[model samples]
Target: MRTATPSRAMRLAAVASQAYRRVFAASRLAPLLSRPNPVHRTGYDLDVVVRRIAHEAEDVVSLTLAPTDGYPLPAWLPGAHLDVFLPSGRQRQYSLCGNPNDRSVYRIAVRRMADGDGGSREIHDGLSEGDLLRVRGPRNAFSLVGTADAYLFVAGGIGITPILPMVRACHERGAPWRLVYLGRSRTSMPFLAELERHDGAVDIRPDDEYGPPDLAAILSHAPRGAAVCLCGPPPLMAPAQRIMRSVNPSGSLHAERFSPPTVAGGQPFAIHLRRSDITVEVGAAESALAAIRRALPDVTYSCRQGFCGTCRVRVLDGEVEHRDRLLTDTQRRDSMLVCVSRAAAGPLVLDL
Candidate 1:
């Protein structure tokens, strides 16, 4: 009594089954399948659990996140930010400060902004270990180009979050890099101990002691062909940018801003929604997005600071006073990130 050999169709089916199982395995496909859909509009779609939370400095807390299913998290690079969905129904972006090579955990440090939009306050007071969080993006609007001969990193207070990983990358690659970490004081500065490990490469400037960083001297002394990566208050970055332009005209300078561009004495404007057949008045004190939301409540938006580009709308007519740092000059020709931008002239017609 001999057993019959399997047919060709049977063998092919077995192979296909194995392949399917392998592809759907926890390690291989979990991270890919867990990625948030870019077109989801509402932003946060992936769920993660807070594995640990520790204070990095005064008013600064670091959160380590892992996928709720215990699978590997999505891989990210230096200067990438994660949009953290808070329990208070607000989404805020925080830079991923941990090693980019670590796929199992994503770390982000948040500084309690005493006078912020309340997202930071929620993260500080509300979120805890074991809490589940909805998150989107390890998105990189400010990424290291890796083409420079040398690098200069300037971080102020919580701004150190994004630059920390970049410094590690520079160290691993043995690239010529210098870090200027500035804060109100040494005690307030997060990652001061970590940065001090690279003593020769870092300059910790506490404003109380140093008054302010000598932007002119720092830029002038920077090695030729160096790219300066700055993440800090606009007041600090604005001067550094000017000095960089004068000292090394050909050098590249990139900045990551945590705040929206200031609009001084903005004139009142109106928005005309073409498809919805509605008009909303944008008062001098309020943003266009706020006014539009009153009429169309379901409009998707996140990071009302204008950095996320989630509330962006196509403009059909009228001039725009584009104030967002996220858009390129070319993009401002027709589209506007309504979170910060307002009308330069009259009623701006939007596709809605």
Candidate 2:
């Protein structure tokens, strides 16, 4: 059976409707359909597969991570570090030691600390080559910036991870640089062979051979106006910081500490956890997080240096003595990082 044909007006109306829909879809109003380029994205959280893992030195192991999505990663600079979330639910930061130009993968070296926390031990023993790990930020708290006559890098033990990239950058730019790589022995230091390949002068002063490096002798090789970059344990960094000022007063000193910074003027304070109904006493030398951890052992925190906001808690009352470098003025009005910040006086009420 033959059906009746559509009227002319009805057919024209249908054609006009189709045209209007097409135009609207391509307009600015349809932003959801227009996907932004992933390359320009910043502060991205991703699950990356461990492509390779290798032992670098006596107690050091390096992990290479590749994006599971098979896309180029966000670009990073010399001193950028990644916040790695382990399968054990522990979060730790490791410096990027690989080439910055190569965006395909990131490389980080970890040294096992026998007496300290368990994060390093987890990476060295438990992490495998095929495991998937979540990571955030190639954020740089220690950036290699500004113009200098030359560069002097002092790396002790695993602190070489961040300064390795900075030395490579200086070599590529045809700038003068010297690295004083310090360790207990040559067998214990990572990247010793890699440093030899660079054109700059590398002084491998093992404590066994050199008998505790003389800061005066080390500074003698560096140019007068050179920028000094140092990262290491408190024993080495504490003295280097003092001598750098005396020897090269004209030079600029940039130091990064792996351990927690020493508390100078902190006074004893109290923190009252509102939800837990418990009060923790913060000692003059101990951090607020340390005190809280004793009362409540399951608190979440990473980078106890106050850069990561994992230990942040809402303040119910009391004036805060802010010491963190991450939070803004708006966020500081109601929040405080227990790892570094403390009460101005008396007791501080926290949301737990």
- Residue-pair clashes per prediction, in order, are 0, 0
- Candidate 2 lDDT by residue in tens digits, 1-352: 6654678668887678556545644565433232212112234676899999988999999999998866566667788788899988888888899998786899999999988678898988898999999998777777785599899998999999999999999989988888999999999999988988863488898999988877767765678889989888888777776787778788888878788887769999988999999988999999999899999977888878878787899999999999998788999999999989988988999998
Q: What's the TM-score of each model vs. the native?
A: 0.78, 0.86
Once fitted onto the true fold, the runs of candidate 1 whose alpha carbons sit more than 4 angstroms away are: 1-44, 264-268, 272-287, 290-301, 304-307, 313-335, 349-352
Error of 1 at 341 (Å): 3.5
The C-alpha stretches of model 2 lying farther than 4 A from their native spots are: 1-41
Q: What lDDT does model 2 reach?
A: 0.84
lDDT of each: 0.82, 0.84
Give me candidate 1's TM-score against the actual structure: 0.78
